[model samples]
Target: MKTAVVLLPGLNRDRDMIAALTKISGTPPVTIWQTETEIADDIDLVVVPGGFSYGDYLRCGAIAARMPVLRALKEKAERGTRVIGVCNGFQILVEAGLLPGALMRNASLKFVCREVKLEVANASTSFTSGYTQGQIIRCPVAHHDGNYVADETTLKSIEDKGQVVFRYAEGTNPNGSMNDIAGIVNEAGNVLGMMPHPENLIEAAHGGDDGRALFAAALEVAA
Candidate 1:
């Protein structure tokens, strides 16, 4: 599959994401700089990795959302190009109006960095096809603004539509997100936004392979 990873200023996880994509996809992913106004054609998936973008000056991902790359991303998403955003990338997706809800400060007012169990809430989408519904997978989450907040009605709508792809399992909600929402997909299922870093857990060296299914599933969909 042809994949592209968008890179923005202040993004510290680009190398990690690049390594993950290379190991999983068997090919180096194209790196799209934030200043670029267009995404490459023939791209099957676009990945927005986690990190403090633009120094998180205003709000995490607030400035990165306005970068030129997102315009191309939005257009590609509308055309059914699969998009996955992790952590701060999730914040950027919400800020760019590609997804619903907002991420607020952690209820504890602290930066949480640790492994958390996530339940596959919806396994039929492109992003979760490799896992069974309700299956728990361990992944690490590191962020302060990972608290997902949305109106009850909106939450209900996404839930009813099966757009809620992943949820914190049991007591694994490290960010105090509303409804324990750890990941969600767009109405069309081509876009996903999640707080956990699956790319950080794809190898045994990272502790477990629970997160491999995510990349494998997306690759299958793109194939």
Candidate 2:
């Protein structure tokens, strides 16, 4: 009942994610570098942290998504592993084809770094289970390519299946994401991707503890 956080060369938040999980899940999470080809057998959750992977080359997460570790991650995800991707990690998941849609340059054409109000669109998924449906929470976002876009048909399909996990609050939509979508989960409900940094809010000293529940909910870490 352990959990693991996969580390990309440029991923810098592994420790923070570990601490978050330890706080709520009551189990210390280990960091598995990208060089590693497989997750530890005892891992119950796999977290992909946010950072400038491959220095944001041609695309935010394009290079990192092709790393050997991602292929292993994809296999585990297919087997129903709980996967959480934040910011650049989210970009990688999309690039890896584990999730849908692409994160383009912010609609403002600027890097946004501020606390944003988000609505919990669906709380049934492992990542959002701690939140009540429609709950509003504030979390900080920092990125240049947080804008989310996809074909209308795909958007409608996801919505129909209740895959949307979070949405920017009305009037607080920092990016021009379609319908203000802020985060989403795959149909399996085991993979979640979002631009906001939940790892940053697991402690009140950092401003809010709204993110603690996400890790607690996703990691059934008893070891």
Candidate 3:
């Protein structure tokens, strides 16, 4: 995929994201700085990697969400370009209004950094096509404000539309997210927001390749 990984001032995972995208696309992904007002026209996928953007000041993703690049991202997402936000990126998505709901302080009030099981709640989207519905995959989660919360009406609507892409598996609600939602897609399915770090689990050295399917599916769409 022709991808761009956003780099925010406080983001710490740009290298990891860049490495993963390079391995998947066979080329280094473009890096878009927070100050950039536009994303490359040729980019097919935009990834927002996990990190403490803006040092989690004010709110986890508040400052970063207002960065210039997100305006471009919102435009691209509205135009049907695919975007995926992992971890803090997910928080940014919510704060930027690209995705629904908000991420709150973990119910436990503790930082959670561990591998958690996730189930493919919906596999019809491009990002999840490599997995079957109800399939289980293990991905790592490392964030303090990863608790996903939304009004009951919105939650029901998303569920009814199959926008809940991934859910924490049995006995695996590590952050006490509502309905155990680990990830979700926008109404159009071109945007995804998830708290898990799939990039961390994509290589053989990472002990498993369960997360490879996600990038493979996205790359296929871009190709």
Candidate 4:
């Protein structure tokens, strides 16, 4: 599977995502800079990794969402290409209107960096197919504005459609997100946005490989 990693100002996790994709898919992904206006048709997956893009000015991912690359990304997603946005990337997705809801400041009003338990709320999506329903896995999160919120109607709609893919488990809701949502997929199921940094925990050297299955499944490769 061919993959591409988006590079934006202040996005420090691009290298980690690139390494993880190369290790899992056995092919290095092309790097797409913020100014690029098009993504190759052959790219199977495009990932927007985590970090404080634009130094979190205006809001997390607010400026990055307006970049030309994001317009290209939205086009790719509309054509059914797979897309994953992690942490600040998640905020960008929502800001760009590729996904629903908004990511607010952490309820604690401080930065949080720790491992959290995640339950596979909907394992049928492309991103979560490698895991079973109700499975719990450990993933690390590092951010200051990971809180997710949506209007009541939108929340109910996503829940009713099984769009909520990952939820904080065992009282691990670090950000006080509504319904403990940690990750979600778009209505078409081709786009995913999450606050966790799966790339950081995808190897044995990182303590375990619980997050490897997600990348493997998205790339259609063995975990």
Which candidate number maximizes lDDT? Answer: 4
RMSD of 3: 1.4
Task: Give candidate 2 misplaced runs (Cα > 4 Å).
Answer: 220-223
Candidate 1, superposed: residue stretches over 4 Å from native: 221-223
Looking at model 4, residue 47 earns an lDDT score of 98
Candidate RMSDs in order? 1.5, 1.9, 1.4, 0.5
Write down the TM-score for model 1.
0.97
Tens digit per residue, CA lDDT, model 2, 10-122: 77767777787777777678877787788766778888888889998999999999998999999999999889999998999999989988899999999898989999999
lDDT (CA) for every model shown?
A: 0.91, 0.86, 0.91, 0.96
Which residue segments of model 3 deviate by more than 4 Å? Answer: 221-223
Query: TM-score for every candidate vs. truth?
Result: 0.97, 0.95, 0.97, 0.99
Worst 10 residues of 3 by lDDT: 214-223
- Compare candidates 1 and 4 on TM-score and give the better one: 4
Q: At residue 88, what lDDT does model 4 achieve?
A: 91
Candidate 1 local Cα displacement, residue 30, angstroms: 0.5
Candidate rank order under lDDT: 4, 3, 1, 2
**Alpha-carbon deviation at 11 in model 2, angstroms:** 1.7
Worst 10 contiguous positions by lDDT, candidate 4 = 195-204
Tell me the tens digit of each residue's lDDT in model 3 across 37-139: 9887789999998899888999999999998999999998999999999999999999999999999999999999898999999999999999999999999
